[model samples]
Target: MDATIEDPRLSTSVEVVFAKQHMPDLRGQVTLRAMAVSVVLGIVFCFVGMRIQLTTGLVPALNMPASVLCFFLLKSLVRLLQKGGFAVLPFTRQENMFLLTCVITCLNLAITGGFATALTGMTSTVAKTLADDPDPRDIVDNVPTGKWILFFFLIGMAGVLSNVPFNQVMIIDYKLLFPTGTVVGQLVNSFHTPEGAYVAKMQVMTIFKAFFGSFSWSIFQWFYTSGNGCGFQSFPSFGLGLYKRRFYFDFSATYIGLGMICPHIVNFGLLFGAIVSWGFLYPFLESKRGQWYETDSPSSLSGLNGYKVFISVALIVTDGLINFITLVTSAAINFYQIRQERDSSELTNYINKLHPSLNYDDRKRIEVFLANRIPVSGPVAGYIACAAISTVAIPAMFSQIKFYHVAMLYMAIPVVGFCNTYATGLTDWSVTPTYAKFVIFVLAAWIGRPGAVVASLLASGITMASLHVSSQAMQDLKSGYMTLTLPRAMVTGQLFGVALSSVVGPCIFLAFQNSTKPGAPVGSKQSNYPCPYAALYRAIGIIGMGGVKELPKYCIELCVISVCVTVAIDTAVLISQKRGWSIHSYIPSMTVIALPFFTGPFFAIDMCVGALLLLLWRRMEAGSAQLLSSSVAAGMICGEGLFTLPSVLLNMFKVLPPMCMKFLPGGQEVEVVDSFLNNSGASRA
Candidate 1:
């Protein structure tokens, strides 16, 4: 009997390999219980991801964390129900993958939506950063929660549907290695094996322990944050002088865990950026404050801060453009090659021959994968309907844009979606933000100010949400291919997940807006939520309208120099890679290096600490480090993130902490103590 053939009288070895599994279907996968689990976990991941996006301007990948938690929770549920004598559906790998897909879909939608960057850029919070007298008109009225929810759904669904046609091209035909998706696929499969299950159990235990400790630490830290510049968050571990430059280890579990997850180059790039901008560049620019600009105010765009914002923008925009061009060229070449190759060879046979390492079960998995196919027409029809609806509805929602603008945008989605997905598969990097920058500039220039900022942001939201969702969908599809799960099930899960997220993301953003002072003045020693990217996006919008010539003295010159430097570095790195030089990986990414210019160096310090700890652990015990690293990091990140909701509620209820603890110089400390004693004596008298 052929091992790949389905038969009732198969051999024992074949049976063992199949595990008596029927044709992979969505029966147990998309059950009510699965959706319930997905939604719950999805909400948690979304909250954490959104919080990170708003604060640090970076949202770490949550797919593995979601997978880990889903497996643990579902496995526990099945066991508990069985022990209680209740009839419970046995947990399966398909269900786990389904849940992971849903949770990750929801998470990506929440964090990648323009809420943290483009949308926030139009608010008064970010407006105050661009100019001392920002336009009241630029402070567009906030979209109502219900309206925002609808907007997200319309765009998000459109985005997800837009890429379904390419699943075959990216996942099957071309065989692009979506790194994260591959990791997730392998992870899902491993969790079903005996040894893998044991390791997963250990991972779950480590995660919970880290979660508890991190959550407790957050609670403890909250007690000392009664006043500004108080608590461990403000601790100047690098001493007061360097701390003033935003270089300090604040012991943040979230950032530290993120550091553990991120590559060393990312952490080093951040620290390098901070040192360059805050420690050296900013100080140098400030020394010429009297000579360069009239006012020394950090908040004014014409002052020292202008150099920071525009210079960072120059680096970001230049880097984005260079990478965008590079990716598009690569994708185009690959597409050409694929077309040429398809002319001479059968795709399935080619695929089979491509992976000689794949054993019989793996081959069988591929057979099961290709059996069920989603028709191309279905996605095309869906995409057209969405595009037509979005064209009409988006213009109605935002008066700055016309129906034709969106119609024009939709025409480009197919080409952009393909490129974005292709690039993502090749590099595991999404250039959606780069796409958004392009849209922002083009639309803002077209609309012209009074309404250009709002128009730019709204246009950016559409482009970004669409491209981001599409790439994520393709990534998930790759995972689906590997797991032998139905593509239709993946789409259904994503649809539900995104629908839930549309409402959840807006509500959370609204909650943060209502509960915290995100609109407070900039340049404070500390802020509840600085939303640095929001301000930077606003700067981009303003620059898009006014042109670079309006920037303060030497700002454009500095920007040009920064762009040239970034280009030179990128060129050097490319050359090194082509030459197969060992030093290429050690080179810091230009994008990561530019991030700290907006957010400051505080989180960078925390991340470096995490990376350092991971390095030492790896040196000590490579096996345990590899085993517990991600799980422990996930636990710590979730613990701190889960506490954010309660903290927000506490702030809302005026439940203030009782004490403020801060370190000061000896003379300042004595003065503060004397003042307190004097005030107390006065009260007693």
Candidate 2:
């Protein structure tokens, strides 16, 4: 091949060697046998992982230490069985880098989780931080917000950031188990760096995207966690002074992505059952007068069953209903998305108009085509909102308790998040609309609910979605973005993410609840978007529609500054268009992000050091990335926040003891196998 003739491929067939690109292999080549097998394995792996995640709470740690360790060993075993005749965890240069990163990350988690626990213990009573609530000893008031500030900071460091090493090691650094027939290999991610200036934008956008998306979790956390609640603690409504919100309704955690997003709906199903059994069934099943004096309690209604039985029945009934709705909605969404994409008539319109803006070149044409297909804000979201509102309102209507509140609530949250630079990125705004920026400016003016808080929030969310689409478009146009291949397609993964997040949210919220605080709730559930905003808007809603005057000039100043910064970078990109700069070339300062998040007196900065070290290994040696990533996983298992620890510990005790008894030199169990083998049919004969 001549150098003048550009191949436009990663590497030519003959030139591809393990020395380059790490993936330089014949496996990637399209072959009848290899392709078929890859396809089958991919599909099977994906099927198992996705379905398991539906109810398993497995994903959180599956890609981490315990699982990572097991998988690595298995990978080694597979290699041993291969023609190479070597069985080893591919502790290539990359794996080493990954392990280093994990070591640092684990150190960080330990420091942060430990410090926070210690601080909480020392500053407050032990009963306060660890236990449920305060005693009935009639004590003095405490500083709730102060407690929460500490709580949230520590939790963020240990749970989210500190775990990055493990995540990178497990997912990015390894060949993941992906679904069949997908571009991503079986359980492994397949990502490519895009060409041109857009790459920088994509990289920056990813950081912000991840930050904003994950930060949104805080909204749900604000409601349920009394220790860190915005104002959702046991407010003295009934006048006893302290009440934990957990005892009321734990709606936030029902669906936050582990399960279905709406646990309450499922609970409502149980409520329905209660109505049937108590109102009708129990009335008829009364032994003579079983129905006559069966008061409010469920136990009394049932003839001789213990209260525990009733409680168990209630839980089962509620969980079932929630799961049923969740399953249906999830299926409907997936089907609708698939069908809408397949049957879209817009393709024809887009095809006809492609010539004007897009280059005739095949690559350019493909990019443009994908760009147009990216949906904008407001296509399906409004309907989804309307459905949610109607469902909530139907129950309210029957109960005669007006829920005009939620009607307005369903309208607002997204836009507010966008204005705060934390857009949910729910909607794809491939095309920006006129006056969108101005509307955002107006909405972002206030801190909370001005009379129509819901509308404002909805507008903000839609606007943010639109902006995200625009950002994606910019990256597409610029050609500098590094595309990320989440092993799981975002659509399905996002659905699962939402479900799990929502389900765990309420539990997290309840854990952090504290009466004395005022701010976003801790471990707040995102199931009900309003749960966070309700108190916030209630607090600052006085700013009103004419909030333009009330808006802090500083906030506006910050927005302007951000816009100016974005434009300056854009200008730089435009100047460098002819001779492109690697997207990283232009990003001058990560200092702002690094100080509070990466460094400072917070958690041990060792984790960030570890991550940075891994990055270094990527450049210095081949295969280092894989090595470092695996190491990180091992380190994390030995660190804080071990999600699947207990189960594995039990399994270890079960399997290890038996294995030790049999395999250890001079052990008692060696004779057992020997005796059993001797008693076999052949021996007996």
> How many clashes show up per model?
0, 90
166 in model 2: Cα distance from truth in Å?
Answer: 33
lDDT string for model 2 (1-685, tens) is 0112224364433122212444211222212222222222222222222222211112222232222232233334445556567543332222221221222222222222211111121211322221123222211124343332332222222122111112221121121112111111111211112231233233333333433442344343343433322232222332221111111222212112212111222223333333333434333434434333332332221222122122222232233333334334544564455445435545333333432332223232233223323243332453344436443643232221124433332333233222221111111111121122233234434423322322332233233232332222122111111122111122212222222222232222233332112342221222111121122221121123332232211333433444454445445644565367665343422111211110011111222233444456567874734433433322332221221232234334542211111112245676776778788956779
List pairs with backbone clashes in candidate 1: none
Minimum summed lDDT over a 10-residue window in model 2 is located at 595-604
Off by over 4 Å in 1: 1-16, 345-363, 515-526, 547-549
TM-score (C-alpha) between model 2 and the true structure: 0.30
RMSD (CA, angstroms), candidate 1: 2.8
Residue 368 displacement in candidate 2 (angstroms): 26
Candidate 1 structure quality by residue, lDDT tens digits, 1-685: 1235444244333224446665546777777777888778887888778777877888877787778888888888788879999996778787888888888888888887888888888877577667777777677656788889988998889888898888877876777999999898888878887877888899999999999999999999989988777889889898888888888888899999999999899998999999999888988887886788877666688887888888888888889888898888888897788777765667655665555444554456556656666898998998999899989888897787788889988999888888889989988989999999888888878877687888788888888988899999888888877777788888888898889899889988876666553434322224656776777777777777773345578887898899999999988888898899978799887888999987789999899999999999999999999989998899889899888788879988899888888877677788989899899999999
The CA lDDT at 237 in model 2 is 32
RMSD to native for every prediction?
2.8, 24.0
